[model samples]
Target: MTSNKEDYLKVIYEENGLERPVSNKVICEKLGIAPSSVTEMLSKLQKQGFIEYEAYKGSKLTSIGGVICIKLLRSHRLWEVFLIRYLGYSWREAHEDAHLLEHVAPERMIDRLEAFLNFPETCPHGSIIPKNGELFENTQLVKMTDLKVGDIALLVRVEEDGDLLDYLERSGIIIGEYIKIKEKEEYEGSVEVLQKEKSIRISYKAACQIYVEKRR
Candidate 1:
Protein backbone atom coordinates (compact mmCIF):
# COMPACT_ATOMS: atom_id res chain seq x y z
CA MET A 1 0.00 0.00 0.00
CA THR A 2 1.31 3.41 -0.90
CA SER A 3 1.21 6.32 1.51
CA ASN A 4 -0.34 9.71 0.84
CA LYS A 5 3.05 11.25 0.10
CA GLU A 6 3.75 8.42 -2.32
CA ASP A 7 0.51 9.16 -4.12
CA TYR A 8 1.49 12.79 -4.64
CA LEU A 9 4.87 11.77 -5.97
CA LYS A 10 3.08 9.47 -8.40
CA VAL A 11 1.26 12.48 -9.83
CA ILE A 12 4.59 14.04 -10.66
CA TYR A 13 5.76 10.71 -12.03
CA GLU A 14 2.75 10.31 -14.30
CA GLU A 15 2.94 13.89 -15.58
CA ASN A 16 6.64 13.47 -16.17
CA GLY A 17 7.94 9.93 -16.84
CA LEU A 18 9.52 7.07 -15.00
CA GLU A 19 12.03 6.21 -17.76
CA ARG A 20 13.93 9.45 -17.16
CA PRO A 21 14.01 9.06 -13.38
CA VAL A 22 13.17 11.89 -10.97
CA SER A 23 15.48 13.20 -8.33
CA ASN A 24 14.82 13.27 -4.59
CA LYS A 25 15.57 17.00 -4.56
CA VAL A 26 12.80 17.63 -7.07
CA ILE A 27 10.41 15.54 -4.99
CA CYS A 28 11.46 17.42 -1.88
CA GLU A 29 10.90 20.75 -3.55
CA LYS A 30 7.46 19.67 -4.70
CA LEU A 31 6.43 18.19 -1.36
CA GLY A 32 8.33 20.76 0.77
CA ILE A 33 10.31 18.19 2.69
CA ALA A 34 13.85 18.00 3.98
CA PRO A 35 16.50 16.20 1.92
CA SER A 36 17.36 13.78 4.72
CA SER A 37 13.73 12.74 5.11
CA VAL A 38 13.37 12.21 1.38
CA THR A 39 16.44 10.04 1.41
CA GLU A 40 15.15 8.03 4.32
CA MET A 41 11.71 7.51 2.86
CA LEU A 42 13.20 6.66 -0.52
CA SER A 43 15.34 4.01 1.09
CA LYS A 44 12.28 2.53 2.74
CA LEU A 45 10.32 2.57 -0.53
CA GLN A 46 13.18 0.84 -2.33
CA LYS A 47 13.34 -1.86 0.31
CA GLN A 48 9.60 -2.35 -0.01
CA GLY A 49 9.90 -3.06 -3.77
CA PHE A 50 8.09 0.16 -4.61
CA ILE A 51 10.97 1.82 -6.43
CA GLU A 52 14.45 1.32 -7.82
CA TYR A 53 16.63 3.75 -5.90
CA GLU A 54 20.26 4.16 -6.78
CA ALA A 55 21.88 6.98 -4.86
CA TYR A 56 22.69 9.64 -7.52
CA LYS A 57 21.16 7.88 -10.50
CA GLY A 58 17.63 8.92 -9.37
CA SER A 59 14.55 6.71 -8.99
CA LYS A 60 11.80 4.99 -10.93
CA LEU A 61 8.88 2.83 -9.80
CA THR A 62 8.61 -0.89 -10.07
CA SER A 63 5.74 -2.10 -12.28
CA ILE A 64 3.93 -3.19 -9.14
CA GLY A 65 4.31 0.20 -7.54
CA GLY A 66 3.58 2.07 -10.76
CA VAL A 67 0.16 0.48 -11.19
CA ILE A 68 -1.08 1.45 -7.75
CA CYS A 69 0.41 4.92 -8.06
CA ILE A 70 -1.43 5.53 -11.31
CA LYS A 71 -4.73 4.56 -9.74
CA LEU A 72 -4.14 6.98 -6.91
CA LEU A 73 -3.42 9.67 -9.46
CA ARG A 74 -6.61 8.78 -11.27
CA SER A 75 -8.43 9.30 -8.02
CA HIS A 76 -6.66 12.57 -7.34
CA ARG A 77 -7.34 14.05 -10.78
CA LEU A 78 -10.97 12.94 -10.71
CA TRP A 79 -11.51 14.55 -7.35
CA GLU A 80 -9.85 17.71 -8.58
CA VAL A 81 -12.34 17.83 -11.41
CA PHE A 82 -15.18 17.34 -8.99
CA LEU A 83 -13.98 20.06 -6.64
CA ILE A 84 -13.52 22.58 -9.42
CA ARG A 85 -16.68 21.80 -11.35
CA TYR A 86 -19.23 21.07 -8.66
CA LEU A 87 -17.58 22.30 -5.48
CA GLY A 88 -16.67 25.70 -6.96
CA TYR A 89 -13.04 25.39 -6.06
CA SER A 90 -10.75 27.21 -8.43
CA TRP A 91 -8.18 25.22 -10.34
CA ARG A 92 -5.47 26.59 -8.03
CA GLU A 93 -7.12 25.77 -4.70
CA ALA A 94 -8.56 22.52 -5.99
CA HIS A 95 -5.11 20.96 -6.37
CA GLU A 96 -4.14 21.05 -2.72
CA ASP A 97 -7.62 20.52 -1.34
CA ALA A 98 -8.18 17.59 -3.67
CA HIS A 99 -4.99 16.04 -2.38
CA LEU A 100 -6.59 16.06 1.05
CA LEU A 101 -9.80 14.53 -0.23
CA GLU A 102 -8.38 11.88 -2.58
CA HIS A 103 -6.81 9.83 0.22
CA VAL A 104 -9.85 9.83 2.41
CA ALA A 105 -12.34 9.13 -0.37
CA PRO A 106 -13.97 5.76 -0.23
CA GLU A 107 -15.46 3.89 -3.16
CA ARG A 108 -18.90 4.77 -1.88
CA MET A 109 -17.97 8.43 -1.81
CA ILE A 110 -16.38 8.18 -5.23
CA ASP A 111 -19.59 6.75 -6.56
CA ARG A 112 -21.54 9.50 -4.85
CA LEU A 113 -19.08 12.04 -6.19
CA GLU A 114 -19.35 10.65 -9.69
CA ALA A 115 -23.10 10.97 -9.53
CA PHE A 116 -22.91 14.36 -7.86
CA LEU A 117 -20.27 15.66 -10.23
CA ASN A 118 -21.83 14.02 -13.31
CA PHE A 119 -18.95 11.73 -14.16
CA PRO A 120 -16.49 14.25 -15.54
CA GLU A 121 -14.03 12.96 -18.11
CA THR A 122 -11.27 15.38 -17.37
CA CYS A 123 -9.95 17.38 -14.48
CA PRO A 124 -10.27 21.17 -14.33
CA HIS A 125 -6.56 21.09 -15.11
CA GLY A 126 -7.55 19.17 -18.25
CA SER A 127 -5.96 15.80 -17.64
CA ILE A 128 -7.81 12.61 -18.44
CA ILE A 129 -9.86 10.77 -15.87
CA PRO A 130 -9.17 7.10 -16.37
CA LYS A 131 -12.17 4.84 -16.68
CA ASN A 132 -12.08 1.79 -14.39
CA GLY A 133 -8.70 3.10 -13.31
CA GLU A 134 -6.94 2.14 -16.52
CA LEU A 135 -3.21 2.57 -16.65
CA PHE A 136 -1.39 4.50 -19.37
CA GLU A 137 1.93 3.71 -20.94
CA ASN A 138 4.45 6.39 -20.12
CA THR A 139 5.11 9.13 -22.66
CA GLN A 140 7.69 11.85 -23.18
CA LEU A 141 7.14 15.00 -21.16
CA VAL A 142 8.37 18.29 -22.63
CA LYS A 143 8.10 21.76 -21.15
CA MET A 144 6.50 24.57 -23.17
CA THR A 145 9.56 26.83 -22.91
CA ASP A 146 11.67 24.54 -25.09
CA LEU A 147 9.62 25.22 -28.21
CA LYS A 148 11.13 27.21 -31.08
CA VAL A 149 9.40 29.81 -33.12
CA GLY A 150 6.59 28.60 -35.41
CA ASP A 151 6.27 25.38 -33.44
CA ILE A 152 2.78 24.08 -32.85
CA ALA A 153 1.96 22.10 -29.73
CA LEU A 154 -0.93 20.75 -27.72
CA LEU A 155 -1.41 22.16 -24.26
CA VAL A 156 -0.72 19.00 -22.28
CA ARG A 157 -0.49 20.19 -18.68
CA VAL A 158 0.47 23.23 -16.70
CA GLU A 159 2.56 23.29 -13.55
CA GLU A 160 0.37 25.49 -11.43
CA ASP A 161 -0.91 25.77 -7.94
CA GLY A 162 -1.93 28.33 -5.30
CA ASP A 163 -1.76 31.87 -6.79
CA LEU A 164 0.23 31.09 -9.93
CA LEU A 165 -2.34 28.74 -11.34
CA ASP A 166 -4.95 31.39 -10.68
CA TYR A 167 -2.90 33.77 -12.80
CA LEU A 168 -2.76 31.23 -15.63
CA GLU A 169 -6.54 31.04 -15.75
CA ARG A 170 -6.90 34.81 -15.57
CA SER A 171 -4.48 35.10 -18.50
CA GLY A 172 -6.73 32.92 -20.69
CA ILE A 173 -4.33 30.01 -20.80
CA ILE A 174 -5.77 26.54 -20.39
CA ILE A 175 -5.28 23.02 -21.53
CA GLY A 176 -6.19 22.06 -25.11
CA GLU A 177 -5.39 25.57 -26.32
CA TYR A 178 -3.49 25.03 -29.57
CA ILE A 179 -0.61 27.47 -29.54
CA LYS A 180 2.29 28.53 -31.72
CA ILE A 181 5.58 29.58 -30.25
CA LYS A 182 6.23 32.83 -32.08
CA GLU A 183 9.50 34.02 -30.64
CA LYS A 184 12.07 32.69 -28.24
CA GLU A 185 14.43 35.09 -26.48
CA GLU A 186 17.59 33.18 -25.74
CA TYR A 187 19.12 35.46 -23.13
CA GLU A 188 16.34 36.42 -20.75
CA GLY A 189 14.44 33.27 -21.82
CA SER A 190 11.00 34.75 -22.43
CA VAL A 191 8.78 33.31 -25.16
CA GLU A 192 5.95 34.84 -27.16
CA VAL A 193 3.06 32.49 -27.79
CA LEU A 194 0.08 32.91 -30.05
CA GLN A 195 -3.25 31.26 -29.42
CA LYS A 196 -6.67 31.81 -30.95
CA GLU A 197 -6.53 35.39 -32.33
CA LYS A 198 -4.34 36.83 -29.63
CA SER A 199 -0.67 36.62 -28.74
CA ILE A 200 0.94 36.76 -25.32
CA ARG A 201 4.39 36.53 -23.82
CA ILE A 202 5.30 34.69 -20.62
CA SER A 203 8.59 34.29 -18.82
CA TYR A 204 11.01 31.37 -19.12
CA LYS A 205 10.11 29.97 -15.72
CA ALA A 206 6.44 29.83 -16.58
CA ALA A 207 6.98 28.25 -19.96
CA CYS A 208 9.48 25.75 -18.63
CA GLN A 209 6.95 24.60 -16.07
CA ILE A 210 4.08 24.28 -18.58
CA TYR A 211 4.50 20.96 -20.32
CA VAL A 212 3.22 20.54 -23.88
CA GLU A 213 2.77 17.81 -26.42
CA LYS A 214 4.27 18.53 -29.85
CA ARG A 215 1.51 18.69 -32.42
CA ARG A 216 3.79 18.72 -35.42
Candidate 2:
Protein backbone atom coordinates (compact mmCIF):
# COMPACT_ATOMS: atom_id res chain seq x y z
CA MET A 1 0.00 0.00 0.00
CA THR A 2 1.12 3.59 -0.57
CA SER A 3 2.35 5.64 2.36
CA ASN A 4 -0.60 7.96 1.84
CA LYS A 5 -2.96 5.08 2.42
CA GLU A 6 -0.99 4.02 5.47
CA ASP A 7 -1.27 7.57 6.79
CA TYR A 8 -5.06 7.44 6.64
CA LEU A 9 -5.07 4.17 8.52
CA LYS A 10 -2.73 5.57 11.13
CA VAL A 11 -4.88 8.65 11.67
CA ILE A 12 -8.06 6.61 11.95
CA TYR A 13 -6.43 4.09 14.26
CA GLU A 14 -5.04 6.76 16.51
CA GLU A 15 -8.13 8.90 16.73
CA ASN A 16 -10.54 6.01 17.10
CA GLY A 17 -8.43 4.80 20.06
CA LEU A 18 -9.14 1.17 19.15
CA GLU A 19 -12.26 1.50 21.28
CA ARG A 20 -14.87 3.20 19.13
CA PRO A 21 -15.51 3.83 15.47
CA VAL A 22 -14.58 7.34 14.29
CA SER A 23 -16.67 9.36 11.88
CA ASN A 24 -15.32 10.36 8.46
CA LYS A 25 -16.00 13.95 9.41
CA VAL A 26 -13.50 13.66 12.28
CA ILE A 27 -10.94 12.21 9.89
CA CYS A 28 -11.56 15.00 7.39
CA GLU A 29 -11.07 17.65 10.04
CA LYS A 30 -7.90 16.08 11.37
CA LEU A 31 -6.29 15.59 7.96
CA GLY A 32 -7.73 18.81 6.50
CA ILE A 33 -8.98 16.88 3.49
CA ALA A 34 -12.30 17.20 1.71
CA PRO A 35 -15.17 15.01 2.93
CA SER A 36 -15.43 13.40 -0.48
CA SER A 37 -11.71 12.71 -0.40
CA VAL A 38 -12.11 11.11 3.00
CA THR A 39 -15.01 9.02 1.72
CA GLU A 40 -12.98 7.79 -1.24
CA MET A 41 -10.00 6.91 0.95
CA LEU A 42 -12.17 5.12 3.50
CA SER A 43 -13.59 2.96 0.75
CA LYS A 44 -10.10 2.20 -0.49
CA LEU A 45 -8.91 1.37 3.02
CA GLN A 46 -11.88 -0.93 3.57
CA LYS A 47 -11.16 -2.79 0.35
CA GLN A 48 -7.50 -3.10 1.35
CA GLY A 49 -8.61 -4.85 4.58
CA PHE A 50 -7.18 -2.12 6.80
CA ILE A 51 -10.49 -0.87 8.16
CA GLU A 52 -14.22 -1.60 8.34
CA TYR A 53 -16.22 1.46 7.35
CA GLU A 54 -19.88 2.16 7.98
CA ALA A 55 -21.56 4.85 5.92
CA TYR A 56 -22.85 7.15 8.67
CA LYS A 57 -21.68 5.29 11.77
CA GLY A 58 -17.84 5.47 11.37
CA SER A 59 -14.76 3.26 10.83
CA LYS A 60 -12.57 0.90 12.86
CA LEU A 61 -9.15 -0.59 12.22
CA THR A 62 -8.75 -4.31 11.66
CA SER A 63 -6.06 -6.33 13.48
CA ILE A 64 -3.51 -5.94 10.71
CA GLY A 65 -4.36 -2.27 10.44
CA GLY A 66 -3.68 -1.86 14.17
CA VAL A 67 -0.22 -3.38 13.74
CA ILE A 68 0.70 -1.00 10.91
CA CYS A 69 -0.54 1.98 12.87
CA ILE A 70 1.61 1.07 15.84
CA LYS A 71 4.67 0.74 13.62
CA LEU A 72 4.10 4.17 12.14
CA LEU A 73 3.63 5.72 15.59
CA ARG A 74 6.79 4.08 16.90
CA SER A 75 8.84 5.40 14.03
CA HIS A 76 7.43 8.90 14.33
CA ARG A 77 7.99 9.19 18.08
CA LEU A 78 11.49 7.68 17.93
CA TRP A 79 12.49 10.23 15.30
CA GLU A 80 11.11 12.99 17.50
CA VAL A 81 13.44 11.84 20.27
CA PHE A 82 16.43 11.85 17.93
CA LEU A 83 15.65 15.31 16.58
CA ILE A 84 15.21 16.82 20.02
CA ARG A 85 18.07 15.11 21.91
CA TYR A 86 20.96 15.08 19.44
CA LEU A 87 19.96 17.49 16.64
CA GLY A 88 18.91 20.55 18.68
CA TYR A 89 15.45 20.70 17.17
CA SER A 90 12.66 22.18 19.22
CA TRP A 91 9.51 20.19 19.92
CA ARG A 92 7.57 21.89 17.12
CA GLU A 93 10.33 21.51 14.54
CA ALA A 94 10.98 17.91 15.47
CA HIS A 95 7.31 16.97 15.12
CA GLU A 96 6.96 18.70 11.73
CA ASP A 97 10.06 17.02 10.31
CA ALA A 98 9.30 13.65 11.88
CA HIS A 99 5.89 13.56 10.19
CA LEU A 100 7.61 13.53 6.79
CA LEU A 101 10.66 11.44 7.79
CA GLU A 102 8.67 8.65 9.46
CA HIS A 103 7.12 7.54 6.14
CA VAL A 104 10.47 7.13 4.35
CA ALA A 105 12.78 5.90 7.14
CA PRO A 106 13.49 2.18 7.09
CA GLU A 107 12.40 -0.12 9.92
CA ARG A 108 15.97 -1.17 10.66
CA MET A 109 17.11 2.44 10.88
CA ILE A 110 14.24 3.25 13.21
CA ASP A 111 15.11 0.28 15.41
CA ARG A 112 18.69 1.45 15.84
CA LEU A 113 17.52 5.02 16.35
CA GLU A 114 15.22 3.81 19.15
CA ALA A 115 18.18 2.22 20.93
CA PHE A 116 20.34 5.31 20.39
CA LEU A 117 17.73 7.39 22.13
CA ASN A 118 17.85 5.00 25.13
CA PHE A 119 14.27 3.78 24.55
CA PRO A 120 12.40 6.92 25.36
CA GLU A 121 8.99 6.15 26.81
CA THR A 122 7.39 9.28 25.41
CA CYS A 123 7.93 11.89 22.75
CA PRO A 124 8.98 15.52 23.34
CA HIS A 125 5.34 16.51 23.75
CA GLY A 126 4.77 13.74 26.36
CA SER A 127 2.97 11.37 23.96
CA ILE A 128 3.71 7.77 24.76
CA ILE A 129 5.97 6.01 22.25
CA PRO A 130 4.70 2.53 21.61
CA LYS A 131 7.28 -0.22 21.91
CA ASN A 132 7.02 -3.31 19.72
CA GLY A 133 3.86 -5.32 20.54
CA GLU A 134 2.53 -2.60 22.82
CA LEU A 135 -0.67 -0.67 22.11
CA PHE A 136 -0.77 3.06 22.85
CA GLU A 137 -3.57 4.09 25.19
CA ASN A 138 -3.97 7.40 26.97
CA THR A 139 -4.94 7.26 30.64
CA GLN A 140 -5.88 9.90 33.23
CA LEU A 141 -5.93 12.74 30.78
CA VAL A 142 -8.35 15.72 31.00
CA LYS A 143 -8.76 18.68 28.73
CA MET A 144 -7.25 21.94 29.99
CA THR A 145 -10.66 23.58 29.60
CA ASP A 146 -12.07 21.17 32.14
CA LEU A 147 -10.00 22.56 34.95
CA LYS A 148 -11.84 25.00 37.20
CA VAL A 149 -10.39 28.27 38.41
CA GLY A 150 -7.86 27.74 41.26
CA ASP A 151 -7.09 24.24 40.06
CA ILE A 152 -3.51 23.22 39.31
CA ALA A 153 -2.64 20.79 36.56
CA LEU A 154 0.36 19.38 34.79
CA LEU A 155 0.76 20.11 31.10
CA VAL A 156 0.88 16.72 29.42
CA ARG A 157 0.27 16.77 25.69
CA VAL A 158 -0.03 19.70 23.32
CA GLU A 159 -1.95 18.97 20.13
CA GLU A 160 0.43 18.65 17.18
CA ASP A 161 0.08 21.91 15.32
CA GLY A 162 2.87 24.37 14.54
CA ASP A 163 1.05 27.50 15.64
CA LEU A 164 -0.24 25.88 18.85
CA LEU A 165 3.14 24.41 19.70
CA ASP A 166 4.89 27.74 19.10
CA TYR A 167 2.35 29.56 21.23
CA LEU A 168 2.83 27.08 24.07
CA GLU A 169 6.59 27.38 23.78
CA ARG A 170 6.49 31.18 24.03
CA SER A 171 4.11 30.94 26.99
CA GLY A 172 6.46 28.44 28.68
CA ILE A 173 3.90 25.62 28.60
CA ILE A 174 6.31 22.72 28.61
CA ILE A 175 5.36 19.15 29.41
CA GLY A 176 5.36 18.36 33.15
CA GLU A 177 5.16 22.03 34.04
CA TYR A 178 2.57 22.99 36.64
CA ILE A 179 -0.07 25.59 35.79
CA LYS A 180 -2.88 27.06 37.83
CA ILE A 181 -6.08 28.41 36.35
CA LYS A 182 -6.44 31.89 37.75
CA GLU A 183 -9.50 33.07 35.89
CA LYS A 184 -11.97 32.25 33.17
CA GLU A 185 -13.35 34.96 30.91
CA GLU A 186 -16.86 33.80 30.14
CA TYR A 187 -17.46 36.76 27.86
CA GLU A 188 -14.62 35.87 25.52
CA GLY A 189 -14.57 32.15 26.28
CA SER A 190 -10.91 32.43 27.16
CA VAL A 191 -8.95 31.25 30.19
CA GLU A 192 -6.07 32.80 32.11
CA VAL A 193 -3.55 30.58 33.81
CA LEU A 194 -0.47 31.16 35.92
CA GLN A 195 2.67 29.37 34.76
CA LYS A 196 6.10 30.02 36.20
CA GLU A 197 4.80 33.18 37.87
CA LYS A 198 3.42 34.60 34.64
CA SER A 199 -0.14 34.71 33.39
CA ILE A 200 -1.08 33.45 29.93
CA ARG A 201 -4.51 33.73 28.40
CA ILE A 202 -5.61 31.26 25.73
CA SER A 203 -8.85 30.60 23.92
CA TYR A 204 -11.22 27.85 25.03
CA LYS A 205 -10.72 26.08 21.74
CA ALA A 206 -6.97 25.96 22.24
CA ALA A 207 -7.38 24.96 25.87
CA CYS A 208 -9.65 22.08 24.89
CA GLN A 209 -6.96 20.68 22.67
CA ILE A 210 -4.39 20.70 25.48
CA TYR A 211 -4.47 17.59 27.66
CA VAL A 212 -3.53 17.89 31.31
CA GLU A 213 -3.74 16.03 34.59
CA LYS A 214 -4.95 17.58 37.80
CA ARG A 215 -2.25 18.05 40.40
CA ARG A 216 -2.59 17.54 44.11
List, in order, the clash count of every candidate structure. 0, 0
| Model 1 lDDT tens row, 1-216 | 446556545744754636667777787787787889888887777888777876686778777667666666667887888777777888788998877777777768777776777787767776666667565532655788777899998887776466668767777876777889889998999888888967877778778778788875
Show model 2 residue runs off by greater than 4 Å: 34-37
| Residue-pair clashes, model 2 | 0
* TM-score per candidate: 0.75, 0.88
Per-model C-alpha lDDT, please?
0.74, 0.85
Give the winner by lDDT.
Answer: 2
lDDT of 2 by residue, 1-216 (tens): 678888888888868636678998888988889999889988988888889887678999988888888888889888988998889998789999998888899899998998888888888988889976686557888998899999999988878778887777776666878989999998776889998998898887789789998986
Cα error of candidate 2 at position 8, Å: 0.8
What TM-score does model 2 achieve against the real structure? Answer: 0.88
Q: How many backbone clashes are present in model 1?
A: 0
